[model samples]
Target: MKKVAFIFPGQGSQKIGMGKDFFENSDIAKDMISKASERLGINFEKLLFEENDKIGQTEYTQPAILLVSSIANAIFKETSNIKPEFVLGHSLGEFSALVSAGAIDYLDALELVHKRGKFMNDACAGSGAGMMALVGLDDEKVETLCKEQREKGLKVWPANYNMDGQLVLAGLKADLESLIDTFKEAGAKRAIVLDMSVASHCELLQSAVENLRPYLEEFLIDSFEVDVISNVTAKAYNTKEEAIDLLSEQLINPVKYKHSIASKDEDVDAFIEFGNGIVLKGLNRKITKKPTLNVSDMTSLKKTIEALNE
Candidate 1:
């Protein structure tokens, strides 16, 4: 039997008018957006469709992306006969996966992610921490370079171990700048810091994790009904407690995404990225070399289901 998996996108994938199609066409999608707006105390529809740059702000972006992805997933579940054998999410996308897997309620996940974005944004507001993408460099070399940079008082570390040759680093601005020269000298194809505000997946975000812990604990998590891969440990979480703790720790740890997808059972036939953008699809192809599809709108969803049926 060919198994299927659903993967959710993270912060960087959010764009204005992301889920407008579903919102206008499906009542289920509209209700989800409305509930998210009430729970988050903001107009999600306006922020998502009307505002051009406002939604990109971390506080709004995190929860907005989650809400859209979850709504899209719900639409698929309600409309299709296909069910995933497992679910995975990238970085902040992990919360969406957990919600879809029945480990946490959608309202809880939405509220938690809103707070998470705020905590992260505030934690690095004035500290000058940020992230960088290093292309064409092996993970081992990146790890070694981070170690060397940290010793030089720059406080840089690997944030996202994305693939065999692509890695993202996070740390103080000065440290990242210093490493750029070293990476280039070491024959790296390109090393550039992302324009993001927070240095996620690094110890620098420990303050954010501390602030988010209490909020996470308040949410009631039930036993997981489906396997949800964790970004922190890169493994499937079996229990509710493990899921909660892993999510809390995810803020302060490297997103071991390469390991998470790699460890999935070999029986998985296809990986469906259930939201905007093809970032996860590209990453999955690099990691597993399997067929992948991106379900962003009705057209893509229909095409994916049709292909699966064939």
Candidate 2:
């Protein structure tokens, strides 16, 4: 069997109708969604299947994405016996990874991330929190510039180390906006401020870190069935104690996505992404030469099973 690592996508991958195919076709998916709706007291069928604005709200977005990702993984597992070498997720996707690793129950994870989103929203509310995407600039240069800005009392910090030439910065909206031209002049092909109210993966979220800890303790199991890569360290960990520490710290630390994939790519022959979109797959193309397949819907699910079986 081909050794594979399972990856999940974070916040930006959500859409209006993700996982509808699974819900419609698989009894397991339907039951999972129904149970999540009952567990959270929010109608997930309406939240996920029908068009609505709540899906975009941070509190709702986190769980919705996780539910769909979890459902995809569940349905895929029903068909394929191939176990992953490890599991990893980006940002909010880490909770999804934990669910896949059997470190947390999916129902508990749904509630955990829902509260996590609320904590993050409360932390950043009215704080002018925001993020910026930089392309074509070297990591060292971006880090240096952000450090200089911080020394000057700006809140800017590198948030997501997505790939070699791409990085995301989180800080006060005004601070990130003010540095756009600076990054552009420093050889960045593009430095655009994202339309985000939550400055994730930065000290701006320090408050959310503590707020999320108790829930992490309540939801996570003692150990993982499969090792999960940490976004904070780009290393693998399995115990719930480590998960609580790292996941809490993750709220205030930049995601080491590129480093995680590049450092561990050789351990797996390929990657299978179980989620709504191919967001991480796109990044893997640049981070490592290993093939990245996705299982988002029934068609892709069958295709991925077939490919992996061969």
Candidate 3:
């Protein structure tokens, strides 16, 4: 039997019609998505199944993505007896991971991420802030650039350490533009600006972290049912309090995903992305060279279950 590790993707992985396949085919998925729609008070299915600009807006986007990802997981669980030995999510996907571990109720997670999206969006309002992916730079160089820029009073920092030579930087829009040419000169293969205006996972969201802390505290999180890794520390979460702390800090700290993937690579036989896109599967291939598959929709889910049954 394969030792599977289910990894969930974060924002940027969400897209129109992401969960429609599973929702249409499985009563299990339909029920969960329907309940989320009622609890969140929005036609989340329409928001996800149809093309709309609101799907891109942070407040609406967060909750919508969570609903789909959670339902996808539920379908996979109901149909197959093969369970993941470990689970982890990237950035916003951590909330989904918490749900998979039975640490947080799915309804609470839906509400939490919706509020989190609002907090982050409000923080970025009029700040002229955003993020960029700088490929071909190592951690030391990226950290040095951030430190030097901060010394010069620029609001820039490494927001995500996805893998070696791939760092996502976030900060004031002006500061990001200033580094483009310099990064190109430093032999970066790409210094692409992300479409998002929100400077997520950086100090710019420090206030958002503080504001979201109390909301997290109100959750009745149980002890984790399965090991779920943390994005901020790139380590396994040991306690409910620790998971909650990191979720808040995740808004303001760099995502240590390279280390997280590396930490688990030797333990699992296969890596599977359970949500919207192939983003996590791609990352696992780039970082760990592991066998990875994505079950984003119904077809992929059937294929994966067959492979597991074999």
Q: If scored against the real structure, what TM-score would every candidate get?
A: 0.96, 0.99, 0.97
Task: Estimate candidate 2's RMSD in Å.
Answer: 0.7
lDDT of 2 at 81: 88
lDDT of 1 at 263: 88
- Per-residue alpha-carbon lDDT of model 3 for 1-310, expressed as tens digits? 8898888878888789888888888888788888888998988878988879999998888888778788878888888887778888888888888888888999999999999999999888999999999999888987887899899999899998887899999999888988899888878899988888899988889889888999898873757888889898888875778877888889999888878889999998888788888887777778986788778888898888888778
Q: Which of the two candidates, 1 or 3, achieves a greater lDDT against the reference? A: 3
lDDT of 1 at 162: 84
Tens digit of lDDT per residue, candidate 1, span 1-310?
Answer: 3579999989789888899998889898899989888887888889889966768788888888888888888888887878788899999888889888887788888898888988998889899988899998888888898897778777988888888888899998877887788999887899998888788988888888889888777874767778898898877776767876888789888998889888884858888888777889888888897788877888888888788888
lDDT, residue 168, candidate 3: 94
Worst 10 residues of 3 by lDDT: 219-228
Minimum summed lDDT over a 10-residue window in model 1 is located at 216-225
Ranking by lDDT: 2, 3, 1
In model 1, the clashing pairs are none
Name every residue pair that clashes in candidate 2.
none
In candidate 1, how many Å is residue 36 off? 1.1
The candidate with the higher lDDT, 2 or 3, is: 2
lDDT of 2 at 275: 85
